[model samples]
Target chain A: MIRLEGLTRRFNGRTAVDGLTFRVREGEIFGLLGPNGAGKTTTVRMLCCLIRPSEGRAFVGGYEVGREAMKIREIVGLLPESPGLYGELSAYRNLDFYARLYGVPKQRREENIERFLKMMDLWDRRNDPVGSFSKGMQQKIAIARSMVHDPKVLFLDEPTAALAPDSAKVVRDFILELKHEKRTIFICTHNLYEAERICDRVAIINTKLITLGSPSQLQREFGSGKTEVQIKNLGSRILHAVKKVKGVLKVEVSGNKLLIQSKDPETVNPRVVEAIVKNGGKILYVTRGAHGLEEAYLKLVGKNEV
Target chain B: MRFDRVWEIAKKDMASVRRHRYVLYGLVVMPLIFAIVVPMITILPFLSAEVAGDNLPPFAPPGFSVKQATILAMVSLLSLIFMFIPAFVPSVIASYTFVGEKINKQLEPLLATPTTDSELLLGKALGAFLPAVGVTFASFTGMVILVDLLTLPIFGYPVLPDLLSLVILFVYCPLIAILSVSVSVFISSKVNDVRAATQLSGVSVLPVLGFYFLFLGGLLKLDWVELALFAALLVLIDAGLFYLSKMTFQREEILTKWK
Candidate 1:
């Protein structure tokens, strides 16, 4: 688990992370979503004990950041923003080097290296120089290096950034598996969909805590409560009749999809669907608009999104 | 304090450095040129039979002949070249070790490791120091073999492994090496480029050159007493420099202040 009490980091007169307060529960996958220059990396670095907080305090695994940094570092692993693997070293050596630094015993170090490599689907390439690997492979090896020590907590900065869609899904599934293992994971990312899909609770931040809740909680609290209906043969008659439904507030047509803003879509979506069915439009599917979290995030972070 | 961590770091760095072509070149070529090649060519003409009984310099001690003094000058020059080895090799490696790692973004993960700042510094210093000391000793052995071969027919004996050369090789070489590693650590903090770090750390050899110049210019004799004094000065400087490097090597400083 990780806790920050008014954690602040300032460079010269400018604050990089200011008064950030949050707690990531054990076994929880916490996503830190922010735009560029939004202090996400800075926050992770401070929590990792790689950089000191300029003000206030932080603790990881019950050890204080400044006072017990070595202990805190011992319990936590970090996949930094860049996959800073030594190019000339083999993947096994890279993992072994970090495992030794983390004081993993020889037998366990070797075992963990092989295990993590296999888990990342890189076991066959373990003997090869990391430089010879592609970007996604290198990223996988870097993640394996962090996990080789089996730290109780992991702070991953953009874990899936370099991966293709399939590889990203693999990493996401691996993260979900880590949650099952009860390891606290802190992730910083700009990929809102990935955050929504994976993170148990997400925090949208910009130099300070902007919002914190589960993905659904955020969607409910900040979403426009709109429904997106995929209807076959959506003509003007059906659109007019759907609008004429009592709870329908507004309707916008794009292709065969109708983005319907209803009065509390949870209680109103069924009536709206029935209204469309009666108007001779066959409903293909009806779901909450996909951009709820995104809209909330844009509204929270404002136009300074980088 | 945790020596295993220190050794592991040093080993990893050495592994990384050996793959670099330029680093390997500097470690090998410069020492070979100074130790084997220059001694074979330059000292040959002087040690030849025709050059005997030449005029001695003003610095030559009482009852010393011109040829003996020339041999002594050859010894000093060879010793100077050997001293430069330890000083020069570390700058090349340390530049790549520190500044190179910073550029590669390797230092952040390294700093995030549980090892303390002193442990990290000692580890990197050892990485640069071991190869330098190895290269210096290896070159000295080569020069000794060549110099003894060249001068054997003239003096009826080998002339190397003398007290001054021994003192410099045993005492001053390691000291100069530590100083060089310390300078690189200090300069690596300020510079972002490996070349810049190497160029800036070239200053570590200034003390070696200063001693050589004073001895050559007849202002100093590198007898045991003077060698002791000079070595004492190096020890003090090495300590101060290690302290300065340690001050600059904090984890927070490395992660935040390093550019």
Candidate 2:
């Protein structure tokens, strides 16, 4: 488990992470969602004992950040923003070297290295230099390197940032597997979909904590009260008519679907449909809550692009 | 101080240094010149044209012919150059291992390991120190053999491993290596580029160069007491620089302040 009480970090008087207070339950997959430069990575670094907080305190596995950095470092594995793998060394050597640094016994180090490599489907290329691997493969090796010591808590900062969709899926599956193994995973990501799909509890942050809850809870509480309507043969006249409908707040057209925001959807939905029907529009599909997380995230983190 | 952790870090960095060809070539070329080329050029002349005590350079034996004194001074001067080996090797390797790792972003995970800052510093310093002192010892061994074989028929004994040579080898080289490693560690923290770190750390040998220039200019006479004093001064400088470097290598400084 990880806990932070009013943790703050500042560089040259400019705050990077500010007054963060939260706790991640043991074995839960927790996501710290933020835009770029939102202090997500900074928060993770403070928790991993890579950097100390300037104000307040934090603990990982009951070990304080600044006081017991060595102990926190011993129990927590960090996958930094970059993979940071040694290019010239073999994958096995890289993992073994970390395991040794963590003081894992030699026999067990060997077993963990082989196990993680095989799990990543990189066992056959274990002997080759990591420089020879592709970006995704290098990421896999980096993931394996972090797990070499069999740490109880893991801090992953953008682990799937630049990976291909399939490779990202593989990383997600591996994270889910770690959850099954009862490891606390704190992930920092700008990928709202990934966080929504995998995180048991998600915290949206932009320098300070904005909101924290399960994905559905956030969606339900802060979900955009927007209705999505797919109209066949939707014309400019029909769009203009819908915009003129009373109580209709905003209308955004994405291809054939009209995402409509309204003050009272129960009353306005009938009027908007009547306006569309009078304008000779054909309706195909009606849906909501499909992208509830994205709307909620954009609402919470603001309209600035992540 | 878990020595196993230190050794592991040292071994890893050394293995990384082994693969960097530029650093490897620098390590190789300098030692070869110090051992083979410099000895042949400095001592070969004394085979027939040396052994007089009257015009002896500093630190020569008390009783010796002109030819013998010149040879001893040459050997002793050559020993002075031996100190340059430790002072130079670390710059090349440390630039690659320390600053280069920082540039390549390989140090975060390294710093994230459970090892304490002191262990990390000692391990890295040893990583640079062992290769440097190894090269110095190996190169010095070659010089000793060549000097003995060249001087045997004239002096009728090995003129090598005399008191000055022993002092420089046992005392001076290790001290110089420590100073250089400390300089490299300090410079590695200050400079982001590997080339800049290497160039800046080369300034560590400026003291050795100053001593060499002073002796050549007849401004210094390194008597036994002077040698001890110089070694003492070097020890002080090494301590101060080491303390500064240790402060720079702390975890927060490394993570937030390095770049």
Q: In order, what DockQ does each candidate have?
A: 0.82, 0.70
In order, candidate lDDTs are 0.88, 0.87
lDDT of each residue in B84-110, candidate 2, tens digit only: 888889888888888888888888888
**Chain A TM-scores in order:** 0.91, 0.81
Report the lDDT of model 2 for residue A186: 94
**Candidate 1 wrongly placed segments (more than 4 Å):** A233-247, A270-281, A303-306, B52-54, B61-64
Instruction: Work out how many backbone clashes candidate 2 has.
Output: 8
Worst 10 residues of 1 chain B by lDDT: B49-58
Flag clash pairs in model 1. none
Whose TM-score is greatest here?
A: 1
